[model samples]
Target: MAPAAITLAAEAPKLSAANTGFMLICSALVMLMTPGLAFFYGGMVRVKSTLNMLMMSFISLGIVTILWVLYGFSLAFGTDKGSLIGWDGDFVGLSGIGLTQLWDGYTIPVYVFAVFQLMFAIITPALISGALADRVKFTAWALFITLWATIVYFPVAHWVWGTGGWAFDLGVIDFAGGTAVHINAGAAALGVILVIGKRAGFKKDPMRPHSLPWTMLGAGLLWFGWFGFNAGSWLGNNDGVGALMFVNTQVATAAAMLAWLVYEKLRHGAFTSLGAASGAVAGLVAITPSGGAISPLGAIAVGAIAGVLCAMAVGLKYKFGYDDSLDVVGVHLVGGIAGSLLIGFFATGGGQSDAAGLFYGGGLSQFWKQCAGVGGVLAYSLVVSAILAFLIDKTMGMRVSEDDEVAGIDQVEHAETAYDFSGAGGGTAARAPQPAPSATTAPNTKKVDA
Candidate 1:
């Protein structure tokens, strides 16, 4: 293994206790988002399939962490390899580095940065689980995350964030994973679903979320943790960029929530809680890439745009005939694209870089650059992810039996259920009255959507 060496920041290489401590807290917050996502997805699934939905996300915490320590971090942040990937024998197993060694030019110990980035690596694939919920086998999902993280995520992170990465060098301003995390996971979700095909009885069965409260709690937790996910991307608060990111995160999320509720009321006649929760996430995704670049007012516009766009997008599956069980492709993919491109119009010259956006007289130059990053990652992830899913499906079978899916994936896959209504009320002597089937009039309620 090669020994770790220092590449000093132009300013001093001295470690700041404040920065280190702040980042450590931020890492914890980001780590919390995985479970938050699990709850978000878990609640959206049918009662019989909730555990499997939760497991699909929680398992990534285990699988990706081990991989990150083994070689995932190395492939993502090690020495530049042809500006396409990273490589450093020293980074494998996170060995050969001293305790105090800094990461490139950062103030925190290399360990802190690795763990922080590891959180990102962990959740990116978990984000895809939302779309594949209830239909996939646990074993196949695990294997797929392993391969997808290594084959698709690691290299893409290098491409967008690592030093000497092509997109980074081209000045594509992804403040924090508009491309690497959200867009990549969203596209991969679309790809895998395309290969696996739709869930059984897609349009026939009423696949509404079993628990909106759980989804709401999950969304709230995600909103809380996102401060860390966005602000901490600046590495530290030394330059005040982190503070701006924090502010913009809040501003944009609030705007998106309101925008979505208004749209829901106008179009559907009532604003549902699911719409509110999903709208919040849409804003979060949209603001993630542009928060550090745009001003607060600009953030409101981005959030509102993404809110409506994603709200309208979630229905595309029904229109186009693919079953994205959750709106992963809609919110994450579309929102990521909106946020990344909006940077070209909203980036103020005072933020992350001096690149003036179109509204600020930067012209169409930066917009084209943003398109390159968005299009490149989307195309690569979609094609490669489809291929990976196909290979995994062919080898071990990705979907469970249709009978098993109908019965409940939790019982088949995990041998457990989220709730046991069987023994309720001491196996009640008399059953409660069941709802009446249609006799005179069929209800025409609008189905609740994610």
Candidate 2:
């Protein structure tokens, strides 16, 4: 690692404590988003399994933080041996990263910066498990995350952001984490959902959300924290590009909200808060890959298109029998692909975006590159996630028993409940009621549809 005082003469202005401080705070702000995700996902599930949903994300914070300190940073950003993975020779257990430590040219205490980036690494995979909720065992999940982070996330993150990775060599312009975060997670989410199979009563039960208000609150927090997520990609203050990313974030979100509502009104017969919230997230995902490179108008188009595509994609669960419990496949995977592909034609250079879409005649080179990046991440993630899930299932056992599942994971797995408003009634009040027998027919009558 470089010393804090070491300066590159021609590498723009060096990062200062003021800039570093802002970034450190932003990094911390981004870290809080995982818990925000917990609340968002938890609120969308049945009340019985709410705590289990929240636990999935919280566990990542505990597990990934430790892993990052161990070797996650070293493997991700260290010197490149080949275009495969980073050579793990420095900053093990936070040894070389001093308070005044420097690396990657910008100055921040390397420890602080590492912790900031670590939060991103931890949450990305956790975000995908939303598709497999209420099924997997807690121990099985822990083992899966530990393995998946090393196998899937760390390698891809290195390829995109680390010096020795393939995408870095190929000039793939993922300003933040379009491929690493969204596409990788989205593909993995799809894999796990398929492996887990549909939830027991998916189509038959009315498994509606316990609280929309909580879901809305979680989405709001994610939006606020995302400023740090998107803007902090620059890693320093006073970068002209950081300001541009910030503006694009809002523009894309606004367009996405409008587009989602318009689509919902046309198809569902009513606009829903869920649709708006989902649309905002779609915009966020779409803009993630192109935020720094594209213009405000480009962001608007990306967000609008992502909103519509993701909205349409969400309905696929009904058409196909996948049951990606909360539409992770629809929103993150689909939206990530849409944004990545669109940016190829829309990305501009020379402070003027002469780069028009295929309809406007930019041809197919950029589009093909974007597709290549997307396809590579998707293929790798599916294979790795399947292996990891299989290993964990065989070792620790992937799911709880059917009886425990019927009783709810919150009570069985965690010994807790999201709501305690039943005084002492507890399980009786919380449990679903049984239907009484009808007196119109004899109790002994054979109940036959035939």
Candidate 3:
């Protein structure tokens, strides 16, 4: 083992109050991302399916949190077993893990690291909900996330982030989670959507977003929360690299938003709010892995490319005959791949890692390594996610009945409606009128003067 790795393993765990506090705050920020995602997805779905969309994202918070504490963390971050996955039940339920012991090289306590990672685990599976929106059974969706997190996310996270994990050892530069979170979730979205099939009126019906304002709000929240997602991956380094990551995140997102707007105006003849929000998200995704390694200029380039490409990519569902309800395949999957692969050309070697990119005179070695990492995660996630979706579909049922789907999932599944139009003579509202206006008392009192 290298000296740094040896030191990481051998050092006694100690606390850094600064790092601990920073990580705690970062965890909270990351936690907000799930709800942010909920709004982002919720707003894009039809009014009838809005709550269900929100629920899908929210449920992951509950399921993954419990699972992570129980064994998800252990499977992802536990002692390495053959570089495939982590092992050891000791970390399950956080058992036998000392409170004072810091993670290998970090100054924060192990518990803090676990919780920080827990936030990532929660959101990754939730990212898939958008593609499967409007048609899935809520119970089945919950079960799918639980199983998917266990089988797919846990092991993949281990591969990308865990010590002695294959990609980690192979030098893949995923600063935050381009491969582990975005690409992984995006690929899984494609797989599940393939199995579940398209929405009922996917092409013929005009399934425009019920509320773009809501989506804009959600996108704003996501942009605010992503700072923690990307910069906090530094884990309280409080150094120049973290600052650089922060700046790059902001710059890349703005550039992507602009790029998306430009593309939209050119292609569709209008600058839509949806385009702006989606473009911002694309920038955020593109910069996630490369932000810490690349310069601000590189960040802009990455964001612009992702913005244009993803905007173009979203239309692929129509061409390819797939119904990616919210374009998860386009924005996340494509954006993630762009970010991870671009690191090969833009990396400055000045950040946390000393690996330089081809443009920086490092050659194509890093680029090929990046391709390997992206391809491996994409392939694994797609295959496993498809099998999981298929098994769930075969055994219990994945999609709701056609009746339930068209009648609105909120009413059919949750027995509640997102918008109540009863007062205005709309949608299932009671038509009870005022009790005849107190017939004897008030009718003529004010008319006496007339």
Candidate 4:
């Protein structure tokens, strides 16, 4: 007798070439944001500290990359242990994870997901560097990030994104990283600035940006790379959500730039290049989380509000005497909060989540959830960052010596300068050799008849 026909179960999740390719490209784009950030921060600093500023951002790429692979990813995305943090040993060195293993619902391999998230981790610490520009020691900066990423970023990423994490389980809606990346970094910046104090010439010297063109170029790059940041968060190329996010990103960024320029013109009587660059960044930060949730019109509102609010917020440091070097607190912290909270009011419930916002007739429930997420991250980051800064200040010393700072941190810290006026045609043109010391003239008298 023939045996009964055997039935086969549906196939397990398999890799999708399109999704893998999309994620890999997104990772590269996200990686570019770090160097773009280096240029942005570099150009904002005085010439003497330009290279140091660039180095501060660049070093995070090196340091965080190593740490991420070793144990950072596991602590961030590994199997959740009570939702506070992941088990570091679960994926330490990416052990026990096979090349063919797919990340839960996504079609990409687990490694691809890991690397993509690694880019986010790399930039979060670098974002803090802008606040401490020129003042902190390079060695100490390096050490601080290594510690901060471990204590602050890893756990925060888990809280916001990890499965079963408190924020994830609590129904908080952070499509990208409004809370984990921007707010976390911004608050950390403020904390360190409070401990490190102001730059030597804060509020007294001009401290103008050495190169506005460099900053403009950096802003362009950041804007270009942000497509990957927001759209790629979807982890798929074919999803309409990515397209919505992409369009919202562009629209919001443009609106924010225009709003900032208008505000600058009205308040300061001039629309400056610096304002344009900064406005663009503020828009980028504001749209990061809300892009996936809100409509393009809502994005315009969010961007415009963030632009105006952050422009005003930048002045808060001067009033409060915090000396936030590059306005990280102003742009990132304020913009992030604006975007995250606005989602509760503007979310259309048309994307991944079904939760509608207040304007969409969902009421104030989502709004309150957003407030809780924002407040929780802000408080946790501020306290932890302050403790970390204080400990480092006590142990290894966070600031350069006064002499080193006054003379220029680039030469003292990195033994290199961003520019050199010692070239053959440089150095004040040699004063034309002083015309042979006016040989025909007396020491104290005017020249005689030649």
Candidate 5:
């Protein structure tokens, strides 16, 4: 009887309450970034759409959070039947993942891990909306996010991060989400931008930011929360590797900020606040892919390159006549590719850790692999995103009417105002507003010929 009982005993894993607590906090930290994005994007747009811009990020909190708990997690991280996607496990609807269960070889409660990742899933799609701002109907945007997550993000995440995922099997290392988050969103942003067409009077319009101060504040908040983002990828405290990644994040961000300011001073004769914030974000995106794999020096290089390339890429839309409103493609897509490829050259140690590049005598093998990986991801993302956008447009329509767009999405869609310049203490416009001596606002005109 004793022998039989021993045979029947389940293998219970030891649990760590402290790790669970740390991870739960990390999840909350990542959640804060969406609002950080709200302010970041809000300050970049015209004053009329300030609330609407922020609401795009706010809406993700409601939509993706609920979907992630229901099935997004299962589809994203569950056991994969092949290299492409995962099967529905009992985790769907979070069934049987109780307060006491283990997850992904961690000692923390599974629920904590699930919620932590869910926040990442929620904010990723919201990041892309900046590329297609000021024109999409609110309802159309909501539906597009839902379908995009279900079809595009989930499968790509499974391919990169899930058990038996193709990239994981191929030794493609992403500490937090260089490929899944940045490159995927970047390419998808391009797809939607092409399908949706340019914003009204893009090149002709001066289209200056209504509030640069708000954008700076948002950048500060995002930088603060990123400690959780990169470190939390380790999913615990007291982790030396996580500590290294944390340090790398700060180092890269500072370097990129300095690099961007220097570039601005060189080109424009003055350092702009917009350049500082954008540079910080570029550095953050570059460090994200290579954070766990490279050294501090590698991080600095990645950040510097990302800063320079992204600053240059922002001007491409003007040259090529595509309106990438907020430089999502410039910063995220270009930065993501730069980091992923640079790691192939800079990686140290041997076996899984040693991904040497052309300079390191590993020859062009690793570089080619990196190129293939980047190309594959970009091609797949662009094609699938276009298809998804087309479907959504065909079924539910994609853009708001020209009249609704002119009126501001806040008034038409959410029925709210971001500011009250009226004297009556309400949101009404001032009846007898006099024009300022100088026009701080850039004129809304078509700047480039299409």
Candidate 6:
């Protein structure tokens, strides 16, 4: 090749509109998962706190977007600092990069890459809201996620995905975010819940989902959006890896849902809607880190293992005396751990990298790498998150007043309610008066619908 031609090639990768368009769609899909999460969690809480639950997740979209644009991206993807963090002055406020400049050698524009990652940051902390439901003060919860994101999430994202990051350097395989997104949020959830304590009634109240249909719908959205979440991490489908990730995602999720239902049926004697929903999420979480690295058959194993493990782990709070309002710890934490570790056992050399898992004759090298990645993210997120929560709890007060909590957080915090129990007229206004029935007392009881 001519020197000028080589110089031009070395200057930048050829931009591809196809890849950029695909990424834009994926970013939108991932963005949709936040509201999907809101609905899923909203339906799980009592009617009294339904809107509050939804708000907890919805608020992240606003909080994290501002943060990401300001400095979160710089800290996460900038030039590496000791493999622990990143810092690029130009990346701060995203002012230095050109709109058309590509991300690392990827075909998509830098703006597209930043926005895609912003979606991940937004949803990661939102995942913590489920474990703190019904008891936390909304403002306190907001502040905590803010501080937690600044202190914990940014550094961790750098470590997991940034160039020269320790995990990236160590050859730890995280195709999507088994550790960065799921385990990070799960551990943080456990930390905060420990400080805030349980819901007001705890074991006495029969707190059940207000609407399983909403939960199912939310789960469906998450599943749909997750195609983008898992596949887009590869950034494109050019070499077919992203397509492989997409297929694996579906296969594993289906397998995990079945595994969870089987566990539920054998253990509880009935297949519940809740079981199906939870199972599906467990599969998604498990496959997220490994999907790009494993075959579809391996994905089934990862999903089934995560489903049963998370199902069994869900009851630990009752036995161990902690209250995780919606099993975030069980599903995200356990499933994340299972999926991360399984990458050591299931990864094939042909998928994402030449490093095979134990089953593929790759030995324990990758397994130990997986262990390190999982442990590092879990420990850091847990400790820093707990400190942030405790500080918030001590200074500003974290939980709502017991009276307000029992009365419903939605009304106390947001001045609204999810449902109205008043007689048919839906507004907050008082009911109109009714006239008395006269001597025609044999009256209106014609087989009416109650």
What are the clash counts of all predictions, listed in order?
Answer: 0, 0, 1, 0, 6, 0
What is the C-alpha lDDT profile of model 5 across 338-363, one tens digit per residue? 88888777765332256666556677
Taken over the whole model, the C-alpha lDDT of each candidate is 0.93, 0.82, 0.92, 0.91, 0.83, 0.92
| Model 6 collision count | 0
Q: lDDT: which is higher, 2 or 6?
A: 6
Ranking by lDDT: 1, 6, 3, 4, 5, 2
Off-target runs (Cα >4 Å) in candidate 2 are: 1-15, 350-362, 424-450
Per-residue lDDT of 308 in model 5? 85
Candidate 3 weakest ten by summed lDDT: 441-450
Please identify which of the two predictions, 4 or 5, would achieve the higher TM-score against the true structure: 4
lDDT string, candidate 6, 119-186, tens digits: 99999999999999898988998898788889999999999999989999998888889999999999
How good is model 5 by TM-score? Answer: 0.90
Model 2: how far is 216 from its true place, Å? 0.2
lDDT of 6: 0.92
lDDT score, residue 414, model 5? 81
lDDT of 2 at 142: 86
lDDT of 2: 0.82
Candidate 3: lDDT of 56? 94
Output the worst ten-in-a-row residue range by lDDT, candidate 5.
441-450
Pairs clashing within candidate 5: 203-447, 203-448, 204-445, 204-446, 204-447, 205-445
lDDT of 4: 0.91
Q: Which stretches of candidate 5 lie over 4 Å from their true place?
A: 1-13, 350-365, 424-450
Please, what is the TM-score per model?
0.94, 0.90, 0.92, 0.93, 0.90, 0.93
Candidate number that wins on TM-score, 3 or 4: 4
Model 4 over residues 251-369: C-alpha lDDT tens digits?
Answer: 99999999999999999999999999999999999999899989999999999999999999999998999999999999999999999999999999997588889999999899999
Instruction: Give the RMSD in angstroms, all C-alphas superposed, for model 5.
Output: 4.6
lDDT of 1 by residue, 1-450 (tens): 323333333446778899999999999999999999999988888888899989988999999999999999999999999999999998999997789888777789999999999999999999999999879999999999999999999999999999999999999999988999999999999999999999988988789899999999999999999999999999998788899999999999999998989999998999899999999999999999999999999999999999999999999999999999999999999999999999999999899999879999999788999999999999999999999999999999999999999888999999998887877674344576657878666555545332
